[model samples]
Target: MKFDKSELQIFANYCVAAAESMAYTLVRTAHSTFVKETEDFSCALASVDGLTFASPRTFGATWYVGLDYGPVIRSLTDYQPGDVCMTNDPYSGFVATHTPDVVMWKPVFYEGEIICFVAGHIHNTDMGGAVPASLSRTLTEIHQEGIRFPPTRIVDKGELNETLLSWMMCNVRAPEQNIGDMKAQIACLTTGERRVLEIVERFGVDAFKAGIGQLLDYSESQSRAVAKTIPDGRYFFAEYVDEDAVGGKPMRIALTLTVDDGLLQFDFSGSDPQLTSSLNVPTGGHPRHALLLVGLNYVLYSLNPEIFLNAGMLRIATCEMPVGSVLNPVEPAAVGMRSLTCVVVQAAVFGAFAQALPDRMPACPASSVCLLNVKTTDTSGRTIMASIGPVGGGAGGSSAGDGSDASGANMAFLRNTPVEINEAEVPIRIQEYGLVADSGGAGQYRGGLAIVMEFKVFAPNTLVTARNRDRTLFGSWGIKGGRAGRTSLFVRNPRTADQDILGNTDLVACQPGDVIRLEGNGGGGYGAPFRRTVEAVERDVRRGYVSRQEARERYGVVYEDGRVNAAATAALRADMAEGPVEANAFFDYGPNRSAHEAVWTRERYVALCQCLETVSVGWRFFLKHQMFDRLAERIAEGEPIDGVQIVFDLFAELKAQFPALAAQQARIKQVA
Candidate 1:
């Protein structure tokens, strides 16, 4: 069968429709709330070479699309009909599908030759790990996190591999749900395989392959055209994660973007060293995960919204990550909570582009994905567990307008998980859920507002895992004179009763009637608050996104009786003098790269990072911070007046004296 241009277009549409249909089936039949309600899954078709050919237009996987399935595809070369290759090892190329996501890949054959691959990924409720839910911020290694599968064939020649199935069942806590979802993913791929074969039968294999190439080529061309429109230049930006979760040491993410001649390069050479925490990112030919940058770029450019997301879009871009860094961790590194790092990575990219294209880019958005896992037992003493929908932060203010309320920047497509579903599934009650008024940064174009959610635990010994609790110092920073957004707050109660502040944790056992309130961070504002129009301030007050006090203090506008007091506002504005914008007032988790440079001196901090290359991942995080803190303490004590350089020099000398450590340092430097 041969497909002409017209037929090729029709076939392409059909393929996209098939993928969407498969996703719909999985969602309707899936067991988890993350999949059914939040829709945190994706299905796509890949060429025999592992390049994505077609993906669903509606649903987006965090790090699954734009991925090259070469490793998984190659592992399944011997696979016959009915064979399914499955893996969630972030290191082997399935980047950070560590838990929740069980990826399934099935090869489509034509005339006894592999022609295409159908892959579907769904977020399972749980995969066996140390914690009840899969995400553990304290996981130090992959073994402690969950079951590991290297590109193994779970189904052979249409037969289920009972040995592998048994192993999975033994490992996971919710074996039934996991296995059921696994079968659901397989069914999705099977649907895609059937659709692809139908197209192959209608159009000859040669024409089908040609259409794939044409579609890829078209996407590549459009991406390059958009890239060319932006002025070619180099941009540098950095963002920090408050900590690595297990420890209080801030992690640095430095990015340099060099765009020239329609080619964009992202270099992540100066990122912080990998930690023992579960925040590490696994590395492989992660084309899909890496294409997160490309997807973000597309959203920023607001290009033709439909380029048919494929591997071709990445042809105009490339990413350079240093091995053993947090962004590209080595083997055995835990990545259970990798999405936390991804939010920061995306912000770093946005920050870099903001430096280059401030007019086109908006101020920094509140970039935290709040995941809360509630675990308890039912009346029968059977364990009951549920993962609440991940809460999204507000979008940053853009040049044209202020940010929206309780929305994510660059990812406005995602929606909040409904309270009804949450109430029905978990042992909790939603006391209050709404937007945090006056949380958005004040400016001419204010940033989006953050969300406020309060929940009461109904079961005894309920375990709760709340990540990214506060964003005060770590909250999104504004550009120009725009003020930073209010940092996130996790409080038990406020102004009335005893309330405990929550920290990022692997688990928290709670008693019944304990209330947990989450106040998310808002995005940074774009321009001066006083410059904002009176009408905008009035609108914010009416909408309950801003209070009258904020209107007068921040925006220099007065609101009375739901109307802006124009004369008072003018007088306030006239009385206010141009001054430095308020700096970010938030908690510093620990010594960030910037703070390290500032507090310990840039040269000293650089020397410490160099020394860190010599030590093991575990020891470096433990000893270096202690040593730096000790040195700072000594300095504060006025102990090193005469022999300051000697003290530093002696420490360096001792580090160099260890031959094994020196050799390890050499190896690390060579690898880096």
Candidate 2:
């Protein structure tokens, strides 16, 4: 059973290939647009203890790489060879499976003893909730989000658990589709199980385990080496989420990174309290989940192409997230849209690094993935819910150059939905999908530009649910002396008709000819614009990223006849002040705290969420709307605010006033 290094390498490769194959099969077989089109699913092989041994590189969010599967494995301790365990309850070690994601795990046995576990998760089209799709922005508790399944054997001894299956089917709107996807997940896990057994047969289980350990060790060593390269010191940074889905309050995330020797500790002590909304993250026991850790690792490892991705890289890094907070929510906490929290986590990581490596790190980019879901009755009156698009954001400016248009720095792999496919699949017209010019942050290395997407609903009363619409408080921040990117705007009409700003809600009816536009935020710049080269300014003007006036005013460069006026630019720069410009004011969720965070706190946000633990979907929607209205008034008035500074100052003051809050803030701020 003992194997050499070569044998271990081969076994590790086999596991990776098998997991990847499983992910491909799931994507090809699934029916939902979120799965098939967006490709939002993942597959992994884990030890019987629920620790991930191998994961797919192309599927799901990269953050789940470090997730531990022990909770799910322990829940299925009595599972037999033919049994399959399923659960989406955050409290039961499920980190935000929510309703759309149906997670299934199967045990792989070698010689009568369980040796490994195969898990496949997919985002189903519907999971029996208040709406056609199980997206609840304002859910206060888990029950209102959807049916909670604890670690339960969904398939026992090769037989389908009809009772459980029937109950799930009866609850969701798209039972057939959900059932089909579930079968697809089962098939994928079976494939992985078979492949894993083959690896064990060829290399022996002992050698296979050895290889896993070696791979992890190699990764950890490489990560430690990278950490050593970073100056040994404590660096702090912070990031934000504009609001919980219900818009009850803007959430702040702070990190204080302690880098001593080669060890890196990310403390999330100063983060905002747990919300009464569905944006909670269930970290299980791994502090913000393994997936997020994997994402951060990937980004750091990406700096050195030779570094291998394994548990070894994470050995030197640790995260401390407070329980009952947004990053590490407790039982019964509504976690339907935990991805929002994940986005903030990514921002925090970037923020912490920005402090340590200001010259190297880029300004903050527009972070969240905008989800637009359109639902309507087709010709035959059958309800159809299709993902209209996942809008892209601007990239952060780096030392090398300005960010690419519509490129997300952290989420570089994300892609926009094809227009041809959208038109063919649904009754809608794509009016405009192009970059928003002059939106990039002005700097020596300018920030990337966001996109302006406009579409019209062809059918009557088409329900539109657009989430992550505004960046009022959490607009991307600049590093060094760079400028912040423009905030995003969601308007019903542009130029011609009166427009209504959209908020988080169940449905907004749109008639034919009504236009909807989403202008995503640009990323922050890295340095002062006046320091930029004349050639760079000219190129931006030629490419439409900068207008002639903006180039002269922001960059202190003048352009004429599509070419830079070198003499004029030099003169302008000479006249420009040399000292650092004032930092842009902070953005706020609303005009006042009473209109934003105060409303949620007044509603006993934590208590409200606890009560919602057993409520229905409709009730969750009502609660979210109620909270949103109170915050929206503040958001509307807080017009042109600095969200980052507000949260940063508020958390700083809170930590000073209360020791417990300070301890929590310290944990969160440590990674900053």
lDDT of 1 by residue, 136-164 (tens): 77778888877878778878888888899
lDDT of 2: 0.69
Off by over 4 Å in 1: 1-11, 60-63, 285-301, 410-415, 467-472, 493-496, 560-563, 575-577, 581-608, 614-619, 631-672
Best by lDDT: 1
Residue-wise C-alpha lDDT for candidate 2, range 217-236, written one tens digit per residue: 76677778877777888876
**Model 2 clashing-pair count:** 44
Candidate 1: what lDDT? 0.71
State which candidate has the highest TM-score. Answer: 1
- Give the per-residue Cα lDDT of candidate 1 at 31: 75
Model 2 bad stretches (over 4 Å) = 1-10, 244-247, 291-295, 503-507, 561-563, 577-580, 583-672
Scored by CA lDDT, what does every candidate get? Answer: 0.71, 0.69
Cα error of candidate 2 at position 429, Å: 1.6
Give me candidate 1's TM-score against the actual structure: 0.90
Q: Each candidate: RMSD to true structure? A: 3.9, 7.3
Lowest-sum lDDT 10-residue window in model 2: 585-594
